[model samples]
Structures are given as structure tokens and as C-alpha cells.
Target: MESPATTKDTASRTQRPEGRPGYGQLLRTDGAWSFLLPGFLARQPYAMLTISIVLLVEHTTGSFGLAGAVSATAGIAMALLAPQSGKLADRFGQGAVLVPQVFLHALTIAALITVASTDAPLWSLFVAAVPAGATAPQISPMVRARWAARLQGSPLMTTAAAFESVTDEFTFVVGPVLATALCTGVHPAAGLIAEAAVSLVGGLIFAAQRRTQPASARAGDAPESARSDQARPQSALAVPGARVLVVAVLGIGMVFGGMQVSLTAFTESIGRPGINGLMYGAFAAGNMLAAVAVGAIRWKRGPQTRLLAGYPALVVAAALVAGTAQLDPWVLVLGALGTLTGLCIAPCMITSFTLIETLVPAGARTEAFTWLTGAIALGQATGSTVAGQLADRSGAGAGFLAPFAGTALALVVVLIFRKALHTPHSGLVAARGVGHRTTVTVD
Candidate 1:
């Protein structure tokens, strides 16, 4: 629901004063807060839905193997289809792309539950999830693209990216908990049902904010000025830093995927598998805090520099985990290390995203972001596979080596392409955003 204050702000249609606004001011802009909040409502359940499905299937069929397979199918679908959905949004528009897809996703949610309830067939669930995921709106990209388009040529662009990272981390933190609660507390299907409803409503509202949508590319490639900044002619993939960034994100994904496995393995090895959530929560908490702080403060350095710096921090942290694996009883120490590592993780992700925005052409923004995410998913799959294999061979604690190895590889990639990351636009973006205060009102 829109807060009364947000409604009032939108109704008034005020603009930010002469200077750049802080995170608080940017959100206070007319329709901005209301527009931004719904993406969370819509996207959080996506994180939750996989676990919900797994739990539901496992509980009903008493087969974790089948449940894992079903859930993996949904994830694979998302990874494969996200870029296509994003391209449609760029070619058509966000509303045209998101509204119908989100609706279909909701229906698929219902159909999957009903079909599964009848014990129709395990393959039925897989079939339903293909459409569910294919139709799933790329809400996360839409949110980032909206902010990028709306704040183009402004300093808050970087801050907006940072804030988006914080939102993602926070949502992951909350999403699983909510799903577990709904599935366990009510019924297995309750969580999926709730997710469907929210995605429907929230996506509708989010897509309605047409002013923030990236401007449509012109027909027959009209002259540049005829289109908005978002409709530039340059190929998005051809953008200077974009390909390297994709490679970097893949490595980052591997690091994250390995960490999840090792953390779970660590807990299980110590005979307290349930404590994994608490430790992961601590990790997310650090990411959230660091992202917020990074967004609020004015950065003297550009994101290219920050991206170069971030990978090494993650490498160190991952190594620390492997080194400390023998201290099985010291969960607190491990958690603290996780949190410290996350501080580096969030900043690296936020900066890379910001740097990419600076490099992507206006017409290809959505696809560019989606492709990066998909690459990360691919990398994560690699990390997960390797970690699981290592665990089977050498026990869970040794699984920590996966993240450390992945991050070390990533650090090398970032260092190799560090210079190309600097762009003419890089310095201007953050400078325009910081050391100034202004009341914001969205266009």
C-alpha cells in the first residue's frame, strides 16, 4: 500500500530544488516512493517461491530428490528466460511486457498447485514451472532500469544502484523466512498463493509508472535527438565495459553460490543445520548495512576503482573461511567473518552495477542487466556443482575452498580489465549526487 505521505507527495507533483537529492530526498519525489516500494512486494516472493515449492513437494511426496529436481527446473527456467523477457520490455515497454507476464505467472501458480494437489504427475510441475518462470517479469531489472532512466545524468544514479543492492540483499534475508513461515504455519500452497497475489498487484502498480519507463527506441532508428537518452543507437553488448562486467558478475555469482554451500555444509557438519539461517542472516545484515552507508555517503572514487578494490576483499574473506574451518565450535567467529566479507560483497556488486549503467546504451539497458544476472546464475551453478562434489569427496568444511577459489579467479579478471572501466561519465555521476540536499519530486 502507498503510504499517506507518498500519496500526498505524488498528488502535489513537486520537483526537487536546484541541487541533487540524497537517498531520502530521491525517494520523497512525487510517485517515487510509491513506485519503488511495489517492486519489493512483487519480487521478494520470487526468492521465496523456490523454497516454498521444494518444501511443499517434499512434504507431500516424501521425496527430497523429486522436490529438488522440481525446484531446479523453475530456477533453470528463470535463468534462461530472463533475458528474453527483458528484451521484450526494451522493444515494447515495461507495462506491455510485465503486466501480462505477471498475470500469467499468478495463474501458473494456481494451476501448478491445483495440478500438484491431484497428484497428476511430477512432470506436470516441471511443465507448469516453465511457463511460470518464462512469464515471470524481471522485476529486479525493471526496478534498476527505472531508477537509472529516471536519474540519468544525475549523481544519485550510483546511489540508486547501491540502494537497489541493499533492497536485493534485504529481500533475500526476509523472503525465505516468510516462505518458511507461510508454508509451515498455514499450508504448503499458502506461500505460493500469497506470492502470486502480490506479484499481480505490485507488478501492475509498478508498470503503471510510465514516466520512469525507459523511452521506447524509435522506428527505423530515427535520428538520436528524436529519442530519449534510453534510445541510443549503440549496441548494448558492444558497450566498452559491458562484456567484461558480465564475465566479472559470473565470477561473483560463483563466489556467492559456493559460500551458500559451504555455509550449509558448515552448519550440518557441526550437527546444527538449522543454524544456517541465523548465520546467513548475519551475512545479509552486513551487506544491507554496508550498501546503505555506501549509498548515503559521497564517494570520492569512481565505481571502476571500487570494483577493482572489492574482489580482493572477497578473496581474503573466502580464504579466511577455509582457514577457520577447523574451528567448528566457533560459529560466532565464522558469522562475524561472513558479515565482514559481505561488506565487501555488496559494495562490489553495487559498484559493478553502477559502472555498467554508465556503459550500457539506453535502448539495451534491460537486456544488459538481465544478461549480467543470467551470467551470475550460470556461475553460481558452477560453484554449487563443484562445492557439492567437493563436499561428497572431502566433507562440508572443505567446501569453503570453492568460494575462495572462485573469488581468486574473479579478482584476476577484474584486475585485467580495470582501466576500461573508467569512462567520461563516471566522475560526473557521483559528483552530481553528493554533498547537496534538495527536495525530490519525480517527473
Candidate 2:
């Protein structure tokens, strides 16, 4: 019973406006591109270098057990110290904290290489790992916070996150191969040295950017506020949505960690050790492709819905991977597809972070985000330890199922608690007028 004119008006209002830039448009922005370049340069090679060093150490020692233990120790150290580092960044600016840390990190890496290449006792190797891990700069979180601060409420923030996720995928996809080639092609020691040098250069370059430097200290503020003002933002964790998101991401991290070892086992069991890298590369490729695709689309639904959907999909993907392991003939093909199904990863992460930004107050932003990072590290460490043990015992097939089961359990818990944990928009909206509130949006 609607008039033709009225119907047309409604349709016009609901339809997406023409000439509106999509994800590509956002990426094309000066600020977006400006941020992207340095971030990519700093992170890409860093990932490759780190992974290569780990693999080299394991190969040289001829002990997976030692490698796993060392990696886990590092992971735990990072998790424990991340919050403190993040808090420092929020108070004194990331650049201030980053510069010194990067130098220390570089030195630690060099020392590790020297000690590792020698016939140092296992205790010496373990002792060196503690300092190396402690000195590791929290670069990823700082970069993320910088982008959030610079870009604010624009869709560009999401785009930036998508870009970061793509970088992560690329790093994982290419890093292992690059690392292996470097170690074998050159020397294992050379790889560690290269990684340390690159990290130092990258960190210094990022710090040198005048625009990206930390804010100058304000005059006449209370001791507490003054301290908090200099630090990275911490307001987000106080919000219910951001809190739940952090928890969920931790679950995802655990699943990823467990899968890492399981994938290695599965590849070896199938008598195709070389294909192990290929399978992992394929998985990362799938995630990259999906992230690009998601960015290309215009979604009417909220990020929360997207995240909820992605979690279950991961569960299904894990199951598919497990099922394929039983069908030896089709394992490779199914493995690829199963990996593709996990394409939702980047988009989900992007959405969750964007939502966190929207919900958290400016004062607490950095700390909240760092907490998410720490949770991920913790989950990964836990997952890796448990999964490695399982694989060592019952066979690789059972290892593959670990992630599936863990993801399923986590998803169920989140869904059951969703209503209680759902963050209201009122607090975020109310804070907009305050100095600490940067942006507020409701969907």
C-alpha cells in the first residue's frame, strides 16, 4: 500500500550511497598509507627472522622438547611483561619505551646467536632466553595503538587493522620458508644476526617519524592522571564488550597455537615433511584472501555478529581438518579447504579491535589493547604445550582434534555468557564530551 514515490524514497535512503569509498578507498588515504608503510617494513621481516631463529635452534639442538620449552618460556615471559610495557607506553609514549627496548632486544638476539651456536650448556641457552624474551619490544600493540589514535573513528581504522592482519598472514606464510632457506642457504647464525639488525633498524625508523612520536607531557596535572596520560590508552578493557572480545581472542590464540604443532605432526605422518610449510602457507594464504574479501564488502551487520559467526566457523573448519586426516587420499585437498574456511580470522580481529576502540575511553585504550595481546600470548603458550604433548603420545591425528575441541568449548562458553557480557552503548556515548573520549558511534 505504499505510494511509488514513498517506496522510491525509502529505497534511496536504505541503499548504500554511490561514490562512497569502500575498503580500497580508505587504504588510499594519505594517513592510512603513511601508517601502513613503516608498519609493514617493521613487522614482515621481523616475523620471518624470529621464526627462523627458533627453527634453527631446534634443528641444531636436535630436540623438539628443548625448542618447545624455550619457545614456551619466551611466550610466557612476553605475556607476563606485556601489560607492564604497555602501561609504560601509555604513560611515557611508545617511542620512549620502544627505542631503548629495541636496542636491548637487538643485543639480546646477538648474544643468543653467539651462545646458541656454541656448545653452551642447555642451562646457558635457557638463561639467555629469559633476557631475550624480557627485552622483546611490544611493537605490535604500539603500532596498533598509534593507528587507532591517528585514524580515530573512520572506517580507515578497520582498513588499517585488515592491513595488519594481512601482514600477520604473510609473515606466517612466508616466514618459515624464508627462515629455513636462510638457515640452510646461508648459516643459522647469520639468520639470527640478520633478524636482530632488522629489528633495530625498523624500530629506530618508526621512532624517527616526527608525527608518530609520543605526545609531550602536559603541565600541572595530578600525579595519577599525569602518569596515565603519558601511557598508552587503557579505557577499553573497562567496557564489557572489549573485555569479552579479549577473552574470545585468547581462545582463538590457543586454537592457533595448538594447530601449529598439530599441523607439523600431520604433515610428517603423511610422509611429506616438506609439505608441512606448504600446508601452513596455504592456511595463511586463505586467511589473507578472506581478509581482503571482507574488506571489499560493505556490511550492514555489526562487528559483534560477525565475530560470533566466525568463531563457530573456526570450529567447523577444525572438524573438517580432523575428518580429512582420516581419509588419507584426500587429506591435502581437504586440508587446503579447511584452512580456507578460517578466512574469517582477520576480519573478525579487525572488527573486534574496532569495536574495542569505539567502546573504551581514551585514558585506558593502550592498556586494554595490551591485555588482549597478553591473553593471546598466554593462550598460545598453553595450547602449544598441551598440543605438543598430545601429539607426542597418541599420534598426530589426535593432535589435529585438540584445536577443534578447544574452539568448540570456548565458543559455547561465549555464547552462553553473551547476554550478560554484552556492553551497553550508553557509557561510551556519554564519555564523548570528556577529554578522554575521542569518538562514539552506535549501531
Candidate 3:
């Protein structure tokens, strides 16, 4: 099913020079820029959602606990539903799933903003959040799948994974800062309003880049062998070690969720609310820097070892951040600690994604990616909810504990499942062949 032109393109790029491909060379892939451009915009709304929700609902109800709870509801909904979205994208194509989903997402976000602004019942906020989160575009995972399609057999796959993580970090840098500035400077509702607009416009543009989208699985494309051997395509969760990775990512999400809410509360308590964005941007900048460094390295070891080595460092960083929040609530100390925390994050995330490429079948690549992302959302929701309550009762310092606890639990999970991370190379090759050439969409 590979086109002659596409085949030739891949063939030309497979031979590596002296070192690994640079980020510049990775972007030179034939159709990379088309999807990457729109994908950057499409992913921003996701980064904005947590901070935007926290600020808006807090303004509406005048309670951080309620704000965190409402944001958690949205995060939990997205986490539960994202895998299904990935499945639909896999089956029906990204455009088919993304176009309608974006419209619904925009509508839901508008309804949420209106409800919050009008001081609707607390229940109404939760109701609006479900569909809003559920319909949020799975652009990050979808874009990663496209990279796999283009660079599956090439060494650039590793670079692509690292670059995507860096891109994700960069959006976090921009999105929260932008949301905070809008909410504090312009209007409380401005951040959510901006999130809705970007999701609508950006999602449509990304969905329109059909040529770069990965192929969807079709009934006809199911090989006779696959049909006779199985009743349905295997779930990505069935892949060995995928669940462990999800648990690990959920822990990281907790750090994010806890940090955002706690940082906001901390700034407010200190009577300098506007500085929250700058501090969060500092955290994200560290993550972006680490991601770049991780990608640039040519590792002889596998992703599993990197994950094992990097995660404990994250736990230590999270603990240090918490200690700093409790002992010295100054902006400068917290900001420095936050950057250290961010530096620990990208390596684990980049390695987890790399493992997905090694472990999951081509048919379930997007779904597997979503599982990790959704875990993050779910974890973030949990962290926010817990930290919000803690901050309300004790102080911002108490909220900082959420991330430390989350990271500790995640380290335990990773250490326990350490052995399962390995898979036979032959099995991976066999699994990847299931539907390699099935095109999901076309220009």
C-alpha cells in the first residue's frame, strides 16, 4: 500500500550520516511541515484549559476548591474519553473524527464560559465540562502518529518523539502564560474565550491536512490472516508495559495539575497574581530545554533504562519543589525549583513515548499515545482537586505536596513493572506490519 513516491522518500532518508539527525533534518521530511504547523496551534488550547478553567471558575464562584473540582471534572472526562477518540480516529480517519469533534468542543466551551459567567449552579459547570473536555481534539497524539507513519523505520523516529515532547513543553510555556495574562489583565473570561476560538480554528486546519494523517484501519484491509486469527483489532492496552507507562504519565500529570493550582494560589496569597504566568513559563522553559537536550543525544541504551534512571530524579525534584514551597514561599526560590522539576520531566516523558513506538502495533499507535496523555489529564485532575482543597484549608504550601506524593507513587509503579518493558524485536516487527499501508486520509 505504500506509494512509489512515499517509498522512495523513505528510502532516501534511511541512511544516517555521522551522527543522529538534527531537528532541522527531521522537519525536512516531505510532508512534515504541513501537519506540524497546524498541530502547534491545535495543541495550544489543551495547554490553556487547566489554567483557564482555574481562573474563570474561581472568579465566578470565589472558591479555589470549587474551581479545582470543576477543572478536575473536565480533566477526568477527557482522560476517560480520549482513548475512544483515538480509536475513532484510527477507524474513521482523523478528519472524520476531528471536524465534528472540534465543532462540538467549541460549542461546549462556549456553554461552559456562559454558565460560569452567569453564576449558574455548581452542577451546571460540571455538566458543561464533560463534553468540553470529551470533544477536545487529540491533536498531540494524532501528530505523533503521523510521524510514526513517515519515519517508522528511520532513526529520526527518536528525534521526532523528542521534538514532539519539546513542542508540547513549548505550548505549556505559552498557553498558561497567555491564559494567565488574559484572565488577570484583560478579562476573567478572556482565556476561555481564546481557548474556544483556537480550538475551533486550529482543529479544522489540522484536520484538513489529510495527506499527512496516518491511515485508518478498514474492514477490507484486514488481512485474511488477521481476520481468521482474530475477531477484532487488539487494543493498545493489550501491549505489554503500556499500562505501566500510563501510570507513570499520570504521576507526571499530578505534578502539573498540583503545580498550576498551587502556584496560582501562592501568587494570590502573596498579592501578586500576575506573576503566576511568568513563574509557570519558567517551569515550562526548563522542560523545553531538557527536551531539546534529550533529543540531541545519541543514546546507546534503550528507552527503558532512560525511564528508570530519569524517574527517580523527577521524584527528588518534586520533593525539593514541595520543600521550597513550604519553607520559602518567595517567587524566586519557587521558580528555580520549578525549573528543576521541569528539567526532570521531559526525559521521562520522551522515554515513555519512545517505548510506545517500540511496543505498540501500528494499528494502535494513536490509541497508545492517547492512553499516556489521558493518564496525564486524569492525574492532573486528581492533583488539582486534591491540591485545591489542601490550599483552601491550610495554605499554598500544602497543595505542593500533591506532586511529591504523585511522583513517589509513580516511581513505585515503574520499578515494579521494570522487567515487562522489554519486548522481542521480532514480535515488534510482526506487530507493526498489521496495517502499515492502510491510508487514513488523502488530499
lDDT of each: 0.69, 0.61, 0.83
TM, every model = 0.77, 0.77, 0.88
Q: Candidate 1, residues 1-443: lDDT per residue as tens digits?
A: 54566445433443554344566766755556756878888888766666566556656765444554566566667779887787677678888888888889999888878866777877897888667656666788888777755554454555466567778889867765566567656887887888788889989988888866776552335235445554445566787688878878777776655655566567657877556656766776787787676666656666676677777887898789777875564999898988887777777776777767677766666667777888766566556556655665677677677778887887787788776676645132442333232222211
Task: Report the Cα RMSD per candidate.
Answer: 6.7, 8.4, 6.1
| Model with the higher lDDT, candidate 1 or 2 | 1
Please provide, for model 3 over 116-222, each residue's C-alpha lDDT reduced to its tens digit, 9 standing for 90 to 100: 98957789999998888888887888998898777755657756766777788899999999999999999999998999899989999999998877777663563
Most accurate candidate by lDDT: 3
Worst 10 residues of 3 by lDDT: 430-439
- Point out the worst 10-residue segment of candidate 1 by lDDT: 434-443
Tell me the spans in candidate 3 whose CA falls farther than 4 Å from its real position. 1-6, 12-20, 151-155, 218-232, 360-364, 424-443
Identify the superior model by lDDT, candidate 1 or candidate 3.
3
Q: Which candidate, 1 or 2, has the higher TM-score? A: 2
Q: Rank by TM-score, descending? A: 3, 2, 1
lDDT of 2 by residue, 312-354 (tens): 8877877777666656635568567646655746655555565
Scored against the true structure, residue 78 in model 3 reaches a CA lDDT of: 88
Q: Residue 274 in model 1: shift from native, Å?
A: 4.1
How well does candidate 2 score on lDDT at residue 217?
Answer: 42
Cα misplacement distance, residue 130 of candidate 2 (Å): 2.8
